[model samples]
Target: MSLITFHRIYPSAIPPMRGDKSALGSLPAAAFQYCEAIRTASSFGWYVFPPLDIELKFDGAEVFCFAEESGWNKLSSLYFEDEFWREWDRFAPDDMKGYRIPYLTTLFVPGIVQIWSGLLVSTASDYSVLVRPLANVVSHRGYQVYEGIVETDRFAPCPLFINIRLIDTSRAIEVYQRDPLFQVQAIHRSCYADGGAYAEKIGLGPPDGVTHGMSATEWDGLRSTIRSAQPLRDSQIGRYGAAVRKRAKGQENID
Candidate 1:
């Protein structure tokens, strides 16, 4: 079982707001359904979530949004603590220059700020984790953005970020002091004790006694030199389709 340790970096960050039956006077059908799902997933070692919230703001948007070369010097003072975001501006690459577009009057906002300023840790040695934005808040802005799969090791854990793309950039948006920002889902890898036996059982081989795994045709299929070519094992789905067809034929004969 994998474990995630969520430490509250800032004192202001708060747990996500969960509306439960006991807290509320009455519960809706969806709320009850979600609660049941949470309970069921918890038993099987899943972190359905209540991720830590991080603060982000586009301070003095009116002024910074209009800033050019002459106004660029003044744009640095727009962050919560003026100097706090300075380091980010310096290290950001040319492509990421658009991220600090407060210097330029632009329609799209980039890198408003990094929410989590500190570190996060995961117990899993090497794993793929997902960072998802709060669904309710994601729809607040017209366009939805997805964060890629983060690979976590013993070193530094992946920090979550909020990517908000507004349909109407003119409208001012604010993330309250303690609003839930994002959630993290730790993706688990599928494991099999005996790979050879499993593949044979799945109908991709020359049966149990004939061969352990990887039939002659399957091995020959892997001889492709193309880097983007699909693996031979991918075609193993045909095994299941064949089984279904055989079962249908048997049923027709009986009928």
Candidate 2:
């Protein structure tokens, strides 16, 4: 079975960077509880919570837009340390230079992961689990929305980028401390492939099951008798062994 593991580059908790005057404070206990639940729920995947707080403010239409000709169209105002931003930016595809879309403003992601082979990791909205920015934290904060999904290598450990984008440009939003900024789900790599054929048809089913294998009605009767409330004595055990040998011989004859 494959596994996914996480590591935090920052040793201590960091405070969220604010573009405006939103006050930073400890989030509700429910926020941390929800994250813990997701973290320990299963062995297949894990959750990465925000190590620090973050905020973005959009004053009406001034800082966001869908207009291709507008300077404020789809801008990312989120900020992080220069070194951290540089490190995460290293993973961006080189062909991005030719793309005309708004540049993905890099932020210092709170977590990293060792994405395993035979699995893929993708992002989910933090709001899905009730982890979100401070409500009504600022005027015009509703304009920006967090971006979804980051590219992950199926077999290597890499830094996870928490990307955001402007949606309405009507308001501002803040990501509080301990918020679940990035959610990762592991997917079997085979899911991406086209299934070839049934296992039994491909000679991959259980070796001695009914499908393509032997059938001994006497063995079935013996199994039923053993499973019943009646206690088995030495005589019954001896009979079972004889039945097993008989079944093996019958299977050999069929082969």
Most lDDT-accurate candidate: 1
lDDT of predicted model 2:
0.36
Pairs that collide, model 1: none
How does residue 218 of candidate 2 score in lDDT? 46
TM-score, per-candidate, Cα-based: 0.41, 0.34
Each model's C-alpha lDDT? 0.39, 0.36
**Residue-wise lDDT of candidate 2 within 16-120, one digit each (tens)?**
222111112233444323332222222223334444444443454333223224433434433334555455456558754232211224233321111111122
| lDDT, model 2, position 166 | 38
